[model samples]
Target: MKFIHAADLHLDSPFLGLTGLPSSLLATVRQSTFTAATKVFDQALAQQVDFVLLAGDLFDRAEQSVAAQAYLFQQFDRLDQAQIPVIVSFGNHDYLADQHQTVAYPKNVTVLGSQVTTKTLTLADGETVAISGFSYPQRWVASDPLPDFPVHAATDWHIGMLHGAVATGSDDHYAPFTVDELLSKRYDYWALGHIHHRQTLNQQPPILYAGNTQGRAINETGAKGAYLVTSDHGHLQPQFFSTATIEWATATLDAANLTTLTALGTRLTDWLASQPAAQPTLTALTVTHLQLDATDLTSLRQGEWLNLYLRTHARQLKAAHRYLVSVTPQVQPQALTAPQLDQQYWDQGAAAVFTPANLQATFGKLAQEPALADWFTQATQDATLRPQAEQVLAELMGKEDPDVS
Candidate 1:
């Protein structure tokens, strides 16, 4: 009893936040989702799993992408050739809709409907298994779907598939359920979706999320992939495998020895040369322990220096198989601490000022302006606002007094 559990394919994802990249890297980024999906199917073929479970959000139906549709049909047929069964439960992004069913998937594919239903399968080894799940009827399902699920069936294994988050008490638009509720069902395993970070809610009977197959943004950094679960001695063992062709990462470089923009560029180039990536990596680098002057720091902040560095060091970037998506200074908080105010006091004041309520109150009537309002809203929501403000103040102090350190 072996199967691959995967979710949040997002096949037509635009890989947002990536701009001003070289044509070659941009092309790779564009194809990264498809490439990552191909690896999953390839793994299925290689492992010869009895079945595959796609928890949800296979593709964004709103996009109406012909390529994504064609790709799914082609890949499903490939699995059909191997006589592998695929169970799909569409999430909010690709909910149950009449238009989408205009063309059906291959015979081996089983797409659950909007209502909870159980599908029973008899493995080649004569073991019976029951799989229960449902697809989202619309963009949001505020109600809890746990009550609709039946207790463990009279089969060798009972797996419950759900595509929603846990009960958060409020603002939970997705089909929310609690761990206790899922445990009450006594299912052998619970395959989850919607949340894009792979994690396990429970070890016994294994309540898990297979996460997205590809990293679509910088925030979704690290290895993105699916899990291969194999039935052990009365328990299921799951293993994660990387499927993403390109990865997003954040790194830091010490600027203790560098003083000029030229020195910084040379050092960055040398650092890239020192470390070559196994795959195309998009890196957000931060310069720490900064000693740069105000003008150079301003250039770095404005992205002018980075743009020039990327353009001139194109060969080095390509050779290293890494792209510097962003470069910024990480000003030490201690540098901004005044003699009159201790570090703890400064921290407390910054925390108090950065609160959502405080920031919103500070914005006041200016928030009425459309464009400025949007930026203000985002700024207030940003977690690093306080740190970024401190960095700005530190830069200003440095500009005012070059020998401040």
Candidate 2:
């Protein structure tokens, strides 16, 4: 039976990590979801797949943009053209019951409800493929979805499909299921989702989460995409397919002892050049222990020539590949003391802002007068602005600053 398995197509992403990129450029990055999904559709059509199984997280959130819906329709339309059947379960991100307007699945699509539901498919060999699943319904599911595993048709094979957090004994606030319960049913294939990383939990019965269709952020790192499951009458062998067109590269140039912007730029450029030709998109970042003495990211954004060069470079490396050159300051291990280890964040800002070099290099330039410098220093004193000042200092230090409130 030919079937395509995929999940977590977070389309029209807000792109929180991506910075300095013009709103237009950001829009383009978000648009890559369509391209990625289109590739999956193309893969399915090429395989002449009889059905498509979406384990979960079909969209980023319940409040997904219309563009996401539109793009999904375009893909489901392609599947519909192939006379393919789409069986889906709602993941934590986008559960159908939570949304105001139900997503319009293609005529051939079958979305399982909040409770256990099943659809029986009659294959050409007269064998039946029974698919059962459920939706998240809310942000958290307290019960184990495995115990609710629908009874299968006693025909050829029964596939238990679900979107949940799987664990034997744990209070994890996601979809939690048990291996013992799953084994008891003995389904031919167990299609799973929710976890971004891919792993083959069971070999005896092929069970898998296709993983997020695309990596939305740096944290969802490494290869992201779907799994292709091939099963005959006896056994099933699942192969992971990397369908993501965008990827994150945590490129670090150790500046612990060495210095100079040209050297840093060279290190970054060399790393970018080292990227394989087949890599569609990459975010190259540099981590410096000592704050670098060079034109900062602000300068790169303001200087017309530098800005033009960076954009041209991103465009030059294939229209799809985006090489984001971001820099972050690295702190030495064992540098932070015990009291500082967990100083409630407020204290860290007090320390970082009062650092000799930072006070001079950053605040010393303020207004040329001691009082103004004192005032600039005092503005960071307020508990309210301490967090903001810390973030500003992060920007100054070339650290991947957390999102400003």
Instruction: Estimate the Cα RMSD of every predicted model relative to the unseen true structure.
Output: 5.6, 10.9
Q: Rate the local accuracy (lDDT) of all candidates.
A: 0.84, 0.66
The residue-by-residue lDDT of candidate 2 on 1-405, one tens digit each, is 767778777666566655556565566667766666677788888888768888877776568777778777778888888788888788766766666544676798887888888888887667678887887787667677676776556757688877766664644545677776777887888888876677777778877777777776665667877766777667766777777776765656566554555555555556556654456455655465655444553443344434554655554444535556455555433322223246557566567675546645765455343223323433234554545555556555444344542
Runs of candidate 2 with Cα error greater than 4 angstroms are 22-27, 168-170, 275-277, 284-322, 334-405
- Write one digit per residue (lDDT tens) for candidate 1, span 1-405: 998999988887776556767988898888888888999999999999989999988884445487888898999999999999999998877777623544579999998999999999898899888999999987678899999999999999999999998887865667999999999999989999987789899999899988888877666788899999999998888999989988888888887878899988888888899988888899989998778877888899899999888889999999998999899888656457654457898788777777778877888987654224424544234565666777778756655654454
Would you give me the overall lDDT of model 2?
Answer: 0.66
lDDT, residue 163, model 1 = 96
Clashing pairs in 2: 165-175, 165-176
Model 2 lowest lDDT segment of ten: 331-340
Residue 350 error, candidate 1, Å: 11
Best by TM-score: 1
Q: Which stretches of candidate 1 lie over 4 Å from their true place?
A: 97-102, 332-405
